[model samples]
Target: MHNDVEEILFSKEDISRKVKELGEKISKDYNRDDEVVVVGVLKGANVFMADLIREIDIPVYIDFMAVSSYGYSTESSGIVRILKDLDLEIEGKHVLIIEDIIDTGLTLKYLTDNLKSRNIKSLKICTLLDKPKRRKCDLNIDYIGFEIPDKFIVGYGIDYGEKYRNLPYVASLKEETYK
Candidate 1:
């Protein structure tokens, strides 16, 4: 028997269901034989992007972008830099930024602007989790998996000091965990 989870906020089933729903929406929005390129932020977004890409039908390509906002803090450093860029050129291709989470939106805003400057045919944002309270920029997310509270959560590709990404579901970290 499987052990009960300590705090499974968004279960695996929930995640799967949401991804399918978002996929359908995206498919309708981007109707074409050629699939849009889905770019995932590094580390935390790896798992979420893997699952989301499978759910999304059409001939899609995948790539990873590694970025760092803060070296050792939860707060944004207000500067975003790409540690790694797409192996596939994004010019003239429909691009969807698949992200694990959107907190302050600084990183995402920076990324979207950068991609726009590349002259892509289309650009959109798709995030599995949204933390509205922390959003610092005006943005629109084409496909959103879940809208969560401002609480600091770990698991389901989120982490606390680089831990808890392996958890099958999301959970708000214990108050004392960050203390």
Candidate 2:
């Protein structure tokens, strides 16, 4: 797995520090007495959500949504599908969507729209990484840990064919690995 990486963009320590910082900001922003619903976009966001929620000081209810625009591919198909939906009813609840990375904004936009129609009290987005250059639609991302270059990265919950998610840090994979 290590050899497959062309370069390491962010180390484990770097990610940890950023997660802690994001958690602090989130805790400060939503310091209300009521618990907030922290929705994790499944598979990729699982690792990020776990670390982030631990840093949050306020009470939080966790749930997962498995939405996909990429299936065994690096580029987005521009078609979004929800493989799994939130188990908790988010109506009238403050909801925060946690994402591993936001590249094209298609999946998140679709998801935010879907969640908004549910009549949730409020909705915000937080992502571990963002590639604004590739955005196809405008989105208001409330929290962002890093603005990365246009590169296909894997590790730290991100993956290529489900093989690199176990890596401890984010890295760009060798072209041959994915090609």
The number of the candidate with the highest lDDT is: 2
Model 2 scores a TM of: 0.97
lDDT of 1 by residue, 7-114 (tens): 567888898899888888887788776547889998789888888878777778888899878645767898987899889987889999988999999989998988
- Per-candidate Cα lDDT values, in order, are 0.82, 0.94
What is the Å distance of residue 128 in model 2 from its true position?
0.5
Candidate 1, residue 28: how far the Cα is off, in Å: 2.0
Question: Model 1, clash count?
Answer: 0
Task: Report the Cα RMSD per candidate.
Answer: 2.4, 1.0
Q: List model 2 lDDT by residue over 107-164, tens digit each.
A: 9999999999998889999999999999999999999999999988999999888889
The worst-scoring run of ten residues by lDDT in candidate 1 lies at 1-10
